[model samples]
Target: MNNAVTIVRVSLNDANTLLELSRKTFFDAFLSTNNPADMEAYASTAFTLPKFQFELINPNSAFYFALVDNEIAGYIKLNYVDAQTELQDPDALEIERIYVLNDFQGQQIGKQLINLAIQTAVDKNLKYIWLGVWEHNTKAIKFYRSKGFEQFGSHPFMLGSDKQTDILMKKEL
Candidate 1:
Protein backbone atom coordinates (compact mmCIF):
# COMPACT_ATOMS: atom_id res chain seq x y z
CA MET A 1 0.00 0.00 0.00
CA ASN A 2 1.17 3.51 -0.76
CA ASN A 3 1.84 5.62 2.31
CA ALA A 4 3.03 8.69 0.47
CA VAL A 5 -0.27 10.18 -0.51
CA THR A 6 -0.97 13.87 0.13
CA ILE A 7 -4.24 15.78 -0.23
CA VAL A 8 -4.46 19.36 -1.49
CA ARG A 9 -7.23 21.60 -2.67
CA VAL A 10 -7.00 21.97 -6.41
CA SER A 11 -6.36 25.59 -7.37
CA LEU A 12 -7.80 27.38 -10.36
CA ASN A 13 -4.32 27.88 -11.71
CA ASP A 14 -3.74 24.14 -11.85
CA ALA A 15 -6.37 23.81 -14.56
CA ASN A 16 -4.20 21.95 -17.05
CA THR A 17 -2.89 19.44 -14.54
CA LEU A 18 -6.31 18.97 -13.04
CA LEU A 19 -7.92 18.23 -16.39
CA GLU A 20 -5.18 15.88 -17.52
CA LEU A 21 -5.11 14.00 -14.22
CA SER A 22 -8.89 13.78 -14.17
CA ARG A 23 -8.88 12.26 -17.63
CA LYS A 24 -6.19 9.76 -16.69
CA THR A 25 -7.94 8.75 -13.52
CA PHE A 26 -11.45 8.64 -15.01
CA PHE A 27 -10.56 6.70 -18.12
CA ASP A 28 -8.59 4.18 -16.10
CA ALA A 29 -11.44 3.71 -13.68
CA PHE A 30 -14.25 3.32 -16.24
CA LEU A 31 -12.59 2.00 -19.38
CA SER A 32 -13.89 -1.49 -18.69
CA THR A 33 -17.55 -0.54 -19.03
CA ASN A 34 -19.96 -2.88 -20.87
CA ASN A 35 -20.62 -0.27 -23.54
CA PRO A 36 -17.92 1.41 -25.58
CA ALA A 37 -20.36 4.18 -26.47
CA ASP A 38 -20.96 4.88 -22.81
CA MET A 39 -17.24 5.01 -22.23
CA GLU A 40 -16.89 7.54 -25.04
CA ALA A 41 -19.66 9.64 -23.62
CA TYR A 42 -18.00 9.59 -20.23
CA ALA A 43 -14.68 10.53 -21.76
CA SER A 44 -16.22 13.63 -23.27
CA THR A 45 -16.84 15.25 -19.92
CA ALA A 46 -13.99 13.61 -18.06
CA PHE A 47 -11.56 15.15 -20.52
CA THR A 48 -13.17 18.57 -20.80
CA LEU A 49 -10.69 21.18 -19.61
CA PRO A 50 -12.97 24.14 -20.18
CA LYS A 51 -15.73 22.64 -18.12
CA PHE A 52 -13.30 21.95 -15.33
CA GLN A 53 -12.14 25.53 -15.50
CA PHE A 54 -15.73 26.63 -15.08
CA GLU A 55 -16.21 24.30 -12.17
CA LEU A 56 -13.10 25.65 -10.56
CA ILE A 57 -14.77 29.02 -10.45
CA ASN A 58 -17.62 27.64 -8.42
CA PRO A 59 -17.20 28.65 -4.79
CA ASN A 60 -19.68 26.06 -3.53
CA SER A 61 -17.66 23.17 -4.83
CA ALA A 62 -14.58 21.58 -3.40
CA PHE A 63 -12.05 19.66 -5.46
CA TYR A 64 -9.24 17.76 -3.83
CA PHE A 65 -6.26 16.25 -5.55
CA ALA A 66 -4.41 13.20 -4.33
CA LEU A 67 -0.70 13.27 -4.92
CA VAL A 68 1.71 10.40 -4.52
CA ASP A 69 5.38 11.26 -4.54
CA ASN A 70 4.41 14.65 -5.89
CA GLU A 71 2.52 13.21 -8.83
CA ILE A 72 -1.25 13.29 -9.34
CA ALA A 73 -2.77 10.01 -8.15
CA GLY A 74 -6.46 10.84 -8.14
CA TYR A 75 -9.11 13.48 -7.48
CA ILE A 76 -12.55 13.94 -5.89
CA LYS A 77 -15.25 16.58 -6.13
CA LEU A 78 -17.84 17.55 -3.53
CA ASN A 79 -20.83 19.87 -3.88
CA TYR A 80 -23.74 20.93 -1.74
CA VAL A 81 -26.98 19.31 -2.88
CA ASP A 82 -30.23 18.58 -1.10
CA ALA A 83 -29.72 15.74 1.36
CA GLN A 84 -33.45 15.44 1.80
CA THR A 85 -33.77 14.87 -1.90
CA GLU A 86 -31.28 12.04 -2.20
CA LEU A 87 -30.69 10.34 1.15
CA GLN A 88 -31.07 10.55 4.95
CA ASP A 89 -28.86 13.53 5.53
CA PRO A 90 -30.33 16.43 7.40
CA ASP A 91 -27.93 18.59 5.44
CA ALA A 92 -26.47 17.59 2.07
CA LEU A 93 -23.13 17.05 0.43
CA GLU A 94 -22.91 15.39 -2.94
CA ILE A 95 -19.68 13.62 -3.79
CA GLU A 96 -19.80 14.69 -7.39
CA ARG A 97 -16.91 12.54 -8.55
CA ILE A 98 -14.11 10.32 -7.32
CA TYR A 99 -11.50 9.08 -9.74
CA VAL A 100 -8.25 7.21 -9.26
CA LEU A 101 -5.94 5.61 -11.74
CA ASN A 102 -6.48 1.85 -12.05
CA ASP A 103 -2.85 1.13 -11.25
CA PHE A 104 -3.28 3.03 -7.99
CA GLN A 105 -6.57 1.40 -6.93
CA GLY A 106 -5.15 -0.63 -4.03
CA GLN A 107 -3.01 2.15 -2.67
CA GLN A 108 -5.75 3.92 -0.67
CA ILE A 109 -5.57 7.10 -2.74
CA GLY A 110 -9.30 6.87 -3.30
CA LYS A 111 -9.75 6.57 0.44
CA GLN A 112 -7.71 9.68 0.98
CA LEU A 113 -9.59 11.65 -1.63
CA ILE A 114 -12.94 10.64 -0.14
CA ASN A 115 -11.89 11.44 3.40
CA LEU A 116 -10.68 14.82 2.27
CA ALA A 117 -14.04 15.52 0.67
CA ILE A 118 -15.88 14.48 3.82
CA GLN A 119 -13.55 16.52 5.96
CA THR A 120 -14.03 19.52 3.72
CA ALA A 121 -17.77 19.28 4.23
CA VAL A 122 -17.37 18.89 7.96
CA ASP A 123 -15.12 21.90 8.01
CA LYS A 124 -17.84 23.85 6.30
CA ASN A 125 -20.25 22.78 9.08
CA LEU A 126 -22.13 20.38 6.84
CA LYS A 127 -23.95 17.57 8.61
CA TYR A 128 -23.98 14.78 6.06
CA ILE A 129 -22.19 13.54 2.97
CA TRP A 130 -23.92 11.73 0.11
CA LEU A 131 -22.93 10.20 -3.19
CA GLY A 132 -24.27 8.00 -5.96
CA VAL A 133 -22.45 4.95 -7.22
CA TRP A 134 -23.54 2.68 -10.00
CA GLU A 135 -25.19 -0.50 -8.77
CA HIS A 136 -22.92 -2.52 -11.01
CA ASN A 137 -19.89 -0.87 -9.48
CA THR A 138 -19.69 -3.37 -6.65
CA LYS A 139 -16.22 -2.32 -5.57
CA ALA A 140 -17.17 1.36 -5.22
CA ILE A 141 -20.29 0.51 -3.22
CA LYS A 142 -18.21 -1.68 -0.96
CA PHE A 143 -15.72 1.06 -0.39
CA TYR A 144 -18.47 3.58 0.41
CA ARG A 145 -19.98 1.18 2.93
CA SER A 146 -16.60 0.60 4.54
CA LYS A 147 -16.35 4.34 4.95
CA GLY A 148 -19.56 4.41 6.99
CA PHE A 149 -21.97 5.22 4.18
CA GLU A 150 -25.25 3.33 3.84
CA GLN A 151 -27.62 2.80 0.96
CA PHE A 152 -30.16 5.56 1.25
CA GLY A 153 -31.87 5.00 -2.11
CA SER A 154 -31.41 4.06 -5.74
CA HIS A 155 -31.97 5.85 -9.03
CA PRO A 156 -31.13 5.74 -12.71
CA PHE A 157 -27.59 6.63 -13.74
CA MET A 158 -27.62 7.88 -17.28
CA LEU A 159 -24.98 6.16 -19.30
CA GLY A 160 -24.92 6.77 -23.06
CA SER A 161 -27.89 4.73 -24.26
CA ASP A 162 -28.77 2.81 -21.10
CA LYS A 163 -29.58 4.22 -17.73
CA GLN A 164 -28.14 1.88 -15.10
CA THR A 165 -29.44 1.80 -11.56
CA ASP A 166 -27.26 3.58 -9.04
CA ILE A 167 -27.27 3.33 -5.29
CA LEU A 168 -27.46 6.58 -3.45
CA MET A 169 -25.39 6.33 -0.29
CA LYS A 170 -25.15 8.71 2.65
CA LYS A 171 -23.32 9.20 5.94
CA GLU A 172 -23.70 11.68 8.74
CA LEU A 173 -20.66 13.37 10.23
Candidate 2:
Protein backbone atom coordinates (compact mmCIF):
# COMPACT_ATOMS: atom_id res chain seq x y z
CA MET A 1 0.00 0.00 0.00
CA ASN A 2 1.12 3.54 -0.71
CA ASN A 3 1.76 5.87 2.21
CA ALA A 4 -1.66 7.53 1.87
CA VAL A 5 -2.87 6.96 5.41
CA THR A 6 -4.62 10.00 6.81
CA ILE A 7 -6.01 10.40 10.29
CA VAL A 8 -9.23 12.36 10.51
CA ARG A 9 -11.18 13.36 13.58
CA VAL A 10 -14.56 11.65 13.65
CA SER A 11 -17.86 13.40 14.24
CA LEU A 12 -21.52 12.63 14.69
CA ASN A 13 -21.92 12.33 10.94
CA ASP A 14 -19.63 9.26 10.99
CA ALA A 15 -21.67 7.38 13.55
CA ASN A 16 -22.91 4.73 11.17
CA THR A 17 -19.50 4.16 9.70
CA LEU A 18 -17.95 4.08 13.12
CA LEU A 19 -20.49 1.56 14.33
CA GLU A 20 -19.77 -0.83 11.49
CA LEU A 21 -16.00 -0.43 11.73
CA SER A 22 -16.02 -0.86 15.47
CA ARG A 23 -17.99 -4.09 15.24
CA LYS A 24 -15.90 -5.46 12.43
CA THR A 25 -12.50 -4.67 13.92
CA PHE A 26 -13.56 -5.83 17.38
CA PHE A 27 -14.87 -9.20 16.23
CA ASP A 28 -11.96 -9.71 13.90
CA ALA A 29 -9.56 -9.25 16.79
CA PHE A 30 -11.35 -11.30 19.42
CA LEU A 31 -13.77 -13.77 17.86
CA SER A 32 -11.35 -16.67 17.77
CA THR A 33 -10.22 -16.18 21.36
CA ASN A 34 -13.64 -15.63 22.86
CA ASN A 35 -16.93 -17.45 23.09
CA PRO A 36 -19.37 -16.59 20.29
CA ALA A 37 -22.25 -16.10 22.69
CA ASP A 38 -20.19 -13.82 24.90
CA MET A 39 -19.02 -11.82 21.93
CA GLU A 40 -22.60 -11.42 20.75
CA ALA A 41 -23.70 -10.30 24.18
CA TYR A 42 -20.98 -7.66 24.39
CA ALA A 43 -21.59 -6.47 20.86
CA SER A 44 -25.29 -6.15 21.53
CA THR A 45 -24.67 -3.22 23.86
CA ALA A 46 -21.35 -1.91 22.60
CA PHE A 47 -21.82 -1.79 18.82
CA THR A 48 -25.12 0.03 18.48
CA LEU A 49 -25.52 3.21 16.48
CA PRO A 50 -27.20 4.93 19.39
CA LYS A 51 -24.22 4.16 21.60
CA PHE A 52 -21.84 5.51 18.99
CA GLN A 53 -23.84 8.70 18.74
CA PHE A 54 -23.67 9.23 22.46
CA GLU A 55 -19.94 8.60 22.59
CA LEU A 56 -19.32 10.72 19.53
CA ILE A 57 -20.77 13.80 21.19
CA ASN A 58 -19.08 13.49 24.55
CA PRO A 59 -16.93 16.56 25.17
CA ASN A 60 -14.22 14.68 27.00
CA SER A 61 -14.04 11.90 24.46
CA ALA A 62 -12.57 11.95 20.95
CA PHE A 63 -12.38 9.54 18.01
CA TYR A 64 -10.21 9.47 14.92
CA PHE A 65 -10.29 7.37 11.82
CA ALA A 66 -7.18 6.22 10.00
CA LEU A 67 -7.94 6.11 6.31
CA VAL A 68 -6.01 4.51 3.50
CA ASP A 69 -6.86 5.40 -0.09
CA ASN A 70 -9.92 7.10 1.40
CA GLU A 71 -11.16 3.94 3.08
CA ILE A 72 -11.08 3.61 6.87
CA ALA A 73 -8.33 1.21 7.92
CA GLY A 74 -8.51 1.76 11.67
CA TYR A 75 -9.76 4.00 14.43
CA ILE A 76 -8.82 5.18 17.89
CA LYS A 77 -10.93 6.45 20.77
CA LEU A 78 -9.57 8.64 23.55
CA ASN A 79 -11.02 9.74 26.85
CA TYR A 80 -9.99 12.50 29.20
CA VAL A 81 -10.76 13.40 32.78
CA ASP A 82 -14.13 12.09 33.89
CA ALA A 83 -14.72 10.32 30.62
CA GLN A 84 -11.85 7.94 31.38
CA THR A 85 -13.11 4.47 32.20
CA GLU A 86 -11.06 4.06 35.35
CA LEU A 87 -8.15 6.34 36.22
CA GLN A 88 -10.03 9.61 35.67
CA ASP A 89 -6.79 11.49 36.28
CA PRO A 90 -6.85 15.07 35.11
CA ASP A 91 -3.21 14.89 34.11
CA ALA A 92 -3.61 11.84 31.91
CA LEU A 93 -5.44 10.66 28.80
CA GLU A 94 -6.99 7.26 28.32
CA ILE A 95 -6.78 5.30 25.09
CA GLU A 96 -10.10 3.57 25.35
CA ARG A 97 -9.92 1.76 22.03
CA ILE A 98 -7.49 1.35 19.15
CA TYR A 99 -8.03 -1.20 16.41
CA VAL A 100 -6.99 -1.72 12.82
CA LEU A 101 -8.94 -3.71 10.27
CA ASN A 102 -7.54 -7.19 9.63
CA ASP A 103 -6.84 -6.31 6.02
CA PHE A 104 -4.79 -3.33 7.15
CA GLN A 105 -2.61 -4.90 9.83
CA GLY A 106 1.23 -4.71 9.74
CA GLN A 107 1.14 -1.55 7.65
CA GLN A 108 2.05 0.64 10.65
CA ILE A 109 -1.56 1.85 10.88
CA GLY A 110 -1.82 0.86 14.52
CA LYS A 111 1.53 2.47 15.22
CA GLN A 112 0.46 5.73 13.60
CA LEU A 113 -2.82 5.76 15.51
CA ILE A 114 -0.93 5.29 18.78
CA ASN A 115 1.58 7.98 17.89
CA LEU A 116 -1.37 10.31 17.39
CA ALA A 117 -2.68 9.45 20.82
CA ILE A 118 0.70 10.12 22.38
CA GLN A 119 0.99 13.44 20.56
CA THR A 120 -2.49 14.40 21.68
CA ALA A 121 -1.52 13.87 25.27
CA VAL A 122 1.66 15.83 24.80
CA ASP A 123 -0.19 18.67 23.05
CA LYS A 124 -2.62 18.88 25.92
CA ASN A 125 0.26 18.89 28.44
CA LEU A 126 -1.04 15.67 29.93
CA LYS A 127 1.37 13.87 32.22
CA TYR A 128 0.81 10.45 30.69
CA ILE A 129 -1.23 8.15 28.48
CA TRP A 130 -2.91 5.02 29.76
CA LEU A 131 -4.92 2.05 28.51
CA GLY A 132 -6.24 -1.35 29.42
CA VAL A 133 -5.42 -4.53 27.54
CA TRP A 134 -6.66 -8.02 28.23
CA GLU A 135 -4.09 -10.14 30.01
CA HIS A 136 -4.57 -12.84 27.40
CA ASN A 137 -3.69 -10.40 24.60
CA THR A 138 0.07 -10.97 24.65
CA LYS A 139 0.55 -9.55 21.19
CA ALA A 140 -1.03 -6.28 22.26
CA ILE A 141 0.94 -6.28 25.48
CA LYS A 142 4.18 -6.62 23.56
CA PHE A 143 3.13 -3.90 21.18
CA TYR A 144 2.39 -1.52 24.01
CA ARG A 145 5.67 -2.33 25.72
CA SER A 146 7.54 -1.57 22.54
CA LYS A 147 5.87 1.83 22.55
CA GLY A 148 7.31 2.67 26.00
CA PHE A 149 4.25 1.68 27.98
CA GLU A 150 4.70 -0.34 31.16
CA GLN A 151 2.17 -2.19 33.17
CA PHE A 152 1.37 -0.32 36.40
CA GLY A 153 -1.73 -2.12 37.54
CA SER A 154 -4.68 -4.26 36.54
CA HIS A 155 -8.42 -4.22 36.86
CA PRO A 156 -11.36 -6.50 36.31
CA PHE A 157 -13.09 -6.24 32.97
CA MET A 158 -16.43 -7.63 31.99
CA LEU A 159 -16.67 -9.02 28.50
CA GLY A 160 -20.33 -9.90 28.43
CA SER A 161 -20.72 -12.35 31.32
CA ASP A 162 -17.09 -13.35 31.46
CA LYS A 163 -15.06 -11.62 34.12
CA GLN A 164 -11.54 -10.99 32.90
CA THR A 165 -8.49 -9.03 33.96
CA ASP A 166 -7.07 -6.11 32.05
CA ILE A 167 -3.48 -5.07 32.55
CA LEU A 168 -3.42 -1.32 32.96
CA MET A 169 -0.43 0.10 31.16
CA LYS A 170 0.87 3.65 30.90
CA LYS A 171 3.45 5.76 29.10
CA GLU A 172 4.68 8.84 30.82
CA LEU A 173 5.15 11.85 28.64
Candidate 3:
Protein backbone atom coordinates (compact mmCIF):
# COMPACT_ATOMS: atom_id res chain seq x y z
CA MET A 1 0.00 0.00 0.00
CA ASN A 2 1.15 3.52 -0.72
CA ASN A 3 1.95 5.82 2.16
CA ALA A 4 1.63 9.16 0.42
CA VAL A 5 -0.78 11.20 2.50
CA THR A 6 -3.04 14.07 1.49
CA ILE A 7 -5.04 16.30 3.78
CA VAL A 8 -8.29 17.69 2.44
CA ARG A 9 -10.79 19.98 4.07
CA VAL A 10 -14.07 18.24 4.89
CA SER A 11 -17.28 19.84 3.70
CA LEU A 12 -20.95 19.66 4.52
CA ASN A 13 -21.43 17.20 1.67
CA ASP A 14 -19.04 14.81 3.37
CA ALA A 15 -21.04 14.61 6.57
CA ASN A 16 -22.21 11.05 6.13
CA THR A 17 -18.78 9.76 5.34
CA LEU A 18 -17.30 11.78 8.15
CA LEU A 19 -19.86 10.46 10.59
CA GLU A 20 -19.10 6.88 9.73
CA LEU A 21 -15.38 7.51 9.90
CA SER A 22 -15.78 9.28 13.17
CA ARG A 23 -17.75 6.47 14.76
CA LYS A 24 -15.47 3.80 13.43
CA THR A 25 -12.28 5.49 14.53
CA PHE A 26 -13.68 6.38 17.91
CA PHE A 27 -14.64 2.79 18.58
CA ASP A 28 -11.46 1.42 17.12
CA ALA A 29 -9.41 3.61 19.39
CA PHE A 30 -11.35 3.23 22.63
CA LEU A 31 -13.75 0.30 22.62
CA SER A 32 -11.18 -2.21 23.79
CA THR A 33 -10.18 0.02 26.62
CA ASN A 34 -13.63 1.14 27.65
CA ASN A 35 -16.99 -0.29 28.56
CA PRO A 36 -18.98 -1.23 25.46
CA ALA A 37 -22.07 0.44 26.83
CA ASP A 38 -20.11 3.59 27.45
CA MET A 39 -18.70 3.51 23.95
CA GLU A 40 -22.10 3.04 22.41
CA ALA A 41 -23.66 5.76 24.49
CA TYR A 42 -20.97 8.25 23.59
CA ALA A 43 -20.95 7.34 19.92
CA SER A 44 -24.70 7.52 19.72
CA THR A 45 -24.64 11.20 20.54
CA ALA A 46 -21.22 12.34 19.45
CA PHE A 47 -20.96 10.75 16.01
CA THR A 48 -24.37 11.49 14.59
CA LEU A 49 -24.87 12.84 11.09
CA PRO A 50 -26.87 15.77 12.37
CA LYS A 51 -24.12 16.74 14.80
CA PHE A 52 -21.49 16.46 12.09
CA GLN A 53 -23.56 18.51 9.69
CA PHE A 54 -23.73 21.27 12.24
CA GLU A 55 -20.02 21.09 12.94
CA LEU A 56 -19.15 21.11 9.27
CA ILE A 57 -20.95 24.37 8.82
CA ASN A 58 -19.54 26.10 11.87
CA PRO A 59 -17.27 28.93 10.78
CA ASN A 60 -15.14 28.51 13.88
CA SER A 61 -14.64 24.79 13.33
CA ALA A 62 -12.88 22.81 10.59
CA PHE A 63 -12.44 19.17 9.67
CA TYR A 64 -9.82 17.54 7.49
CA PHE A 65 -9.52 14.07 6.08
CA ALA A 66 -6.17 12.40 5.87
CA LEU A 67 -6.18 10.30 2.74
CA VAL A 68 -3.57 7.74 1.83
CA ASP A 69 -3.54 6.41 -1.71
CA ASN A 70 -6.93 8.03 -2.15
CA GLU A 71 -8.32 6.16 0.83
CA ILE A 72 -9.67 7.83 3.93
CA ALA A 73 -7.07 6.78 6.47
CA GLY A 74 -8.05 9.15 9.26
CA TYR A 75 -9.31 12.64 10.02
CA ILE A 76 -8.91 15.67 12.28
CA LYS A 77 -11.22 18.29 13.76
CA LEU A 78 -10.10 21.77 14.79
CA ASN A 79 -12.04 24.43 16.61
CA TYR A 80 -11.52 28.09 17.30
CA VAL A 81 -13.04 30.64 19.68
CA ASP A 82 -16.47 29.62 20.97
CA ALA A 83 -16.34 26.44 19.00
CA GLN A 84 -13.67 25.07 21.28
CA THR A 85 -14.86 22.43 23.69
CA GLU A 86 -13.14 24.30 26.48
CA LEU A 87 -11.15 27.45 27.18
CA GLN A 88 -12.83 29.09 24.15
CA ASP A 89 -9.92 31.44 23.85
CA PRO A 90 -10.04 33.53 20.70
CA ASP A 91 -6.27 33.36 20.45
CA ALA A 92 -5.97 29.59 20.66
CA LEU A 93 -6.73 26.71 18.33
CA GLU A 94 -8.27 23.55 19.72
CA ILE A 95 -7.65 20.09 18.35
CA GLU A 96 -10.98 18.60 19.12
CA ARG A 97 -10.14 15.20 17.72
CA ILE A 98 -7.55 13.32 15.68
CA TYR A 99 -7.87 9.64 14.91
CA VAL A 100 -6.52 7.07 12.48
CA LEU A 101 -7.81 3.64 11.60
CA ASN A 102 -6.07 0.68 13.18
CA ASP A 103 -4.69 -0.26 9.79
CA PHE A 104 -3.33 3.23 9.24
CA GLN A 105 -1.59 3.75 12.57
CA GLY A 106 2.17 4.40 12.83
CA GLN A 107 2.41 5.82 9.30
CA GLN A 108 2.96 9.48 10.25
CA ILE A 109 -0.59 10.44 9.29
CA GLY A 110 -1.34 11.70 12.79
CA LYS A 111 1.96 13.56 12.80
CA GLN A 112 1.04 15.27 9.56
CA LEU A 113 -2.30 16.29 10.99
CA ILE A 114 -0.59 17.68 14.08
CA ASN A 115 1.82 19.61 11.91
CA LEU A 116 -1.07 21.04 9.98
CA ALA A 117 -2.77 22.09 13.22
CA ILE A 118 0.45 23.79 14.31
CA GLN A 119 0.79 25.55 10.99
CA THR A 120 -2.85 26.56 11.05
CA ALA A 121 -2.33 28.08 14.49
CA VAL A 122 0.76 29.89 13.32
CA ASP A 123 -1.01 31.22 10.25
CA LYS A 124 -3.78 32.59 12.41
CA ASN A 125 -1.28 34.12 14.82
CA LEU A 126 -2.82 32.06 17.57
CA LYS A 127 -1.17 31.91 20.97
CA TYR A 128 -1.29 28.13 21.24
CA ILE A 129 -2.77 24.83 20.11
CA TRP A 130 -4.47 22.70 22.70
CA LEU A 131 -6.32 19.40 23.07
CA GLY A 132 -7.85 17.08 25.62
CA VAL A 133 -6.84 13.45 25.75
CA TRP A 134 -8.25 10.84 28.02
CA GLU A 135 -6.17 10.70 31.17
CA HIS A 136 -5.58 6.98 30.70
CA ASN A 137 -4.60 7.25 27.08
CA THR A 138 -0.88 7.34 27.66
CA LYS A 139 -0.05 6.64 24.04
CA ALA A 140 -1.78 9.77 22.91
CA ILE A 141 -0.34 11.75 25.81
CA LYS A 142 3.15 10.62 24.83
CA PHE A 143 2.53 11.58 21.23
CA TYR A 144 1.33 15.04 22.21
CA ARG A 145 4.30 15.49 24.52
CA SER A 146 6.65 14.57 21.71
CA LYS A 147 5.02 17.31 19.65
CA GLY A 148 5.93 19.83 22.37
CA PHE A 149 2.67 19.85 24.28
CA GLU A 150 2.65 20.00 28.07
CA GLN A 151 -0.11 19.20 30.49
CA PHE A 152 -1.53 22.32 32.07
CA GLY A 153 -4.91 21.24 33.38
CA SER A 154 -7.74 18.75 33.05
CA HIS A 155 -11.44 18.63 32.45
CA PRO A 156 -14.30 16.21 32.77
CA PHE A 157 -15.31 14.28 29.69
CA MET A 158 -18.56 12.46 29.89
CA LEU A 159 -18.30 9.28 27.92
CA GLY A 160 -21.79 8.02 28.27
CA SER A 161 -22.18 8.24 32.04
CA ASP A 162 -18.61 7.40 32.89
CA LYS A 163 -17.50 10.91 33.74
CA GLN A 164 -13.89 10.58 32.74
CA THR A 165 -11.07 13.03 33.23
CA ASP A 166 -9.08 14.33 30.30
CA ILE A 167 -5.62 15.81 30.59
CA LEU A 168 -5.50 19.16 28.89
CA MET A 169 -2.30 19.81 27.00
CA LYS A 170 -1.10 22.76 24.98
CA LYS A 171 1.68 23.80 22.64
CA GLU A 172 2.39 27.50 22.57
CA LEU A 173 3.24 28.91 19.17
lDDT of 1 at 164: 86
Residue 85 in model 3: lDDT: 89
Q: Candidate 1 lDDT, tens digit per residue, 92-162?
A: 78897898877677888888888787777788788788888888888898899999999988898777667
TM-score of each: 0.87, 0.97, 0.97
Q: What are the Cα lDDT values of the candidates?
A: 0.78, 0.94, 0.94
By TM-score, is 1 or 3 better?
3
**How much is the lDDT of residue 81 in candidate 1?**
48
Task: List model 2 lDDT by residue over 1-173, tens digit each.
Answer: 55778999999999999999999988999999999898999999989998889999999999999999898999999999999999799999999999999888888999999999999999999999999999999988999998999999999988899999999999999
Stretches > 4 Å off in candidate 2: none
Sort order, TM-score high to low: 3, 2, 1
Angstrom error of the Cα, residue 110, model 3: value is: 0.3
Looking at candidate 1, what is the lDDT of residue 26? 61
TM-score-superior candidate, 1 or 2: 2
| Candidate 1 lDDT | 0.78
Give the winner by lDDT: 1 or 2. 2
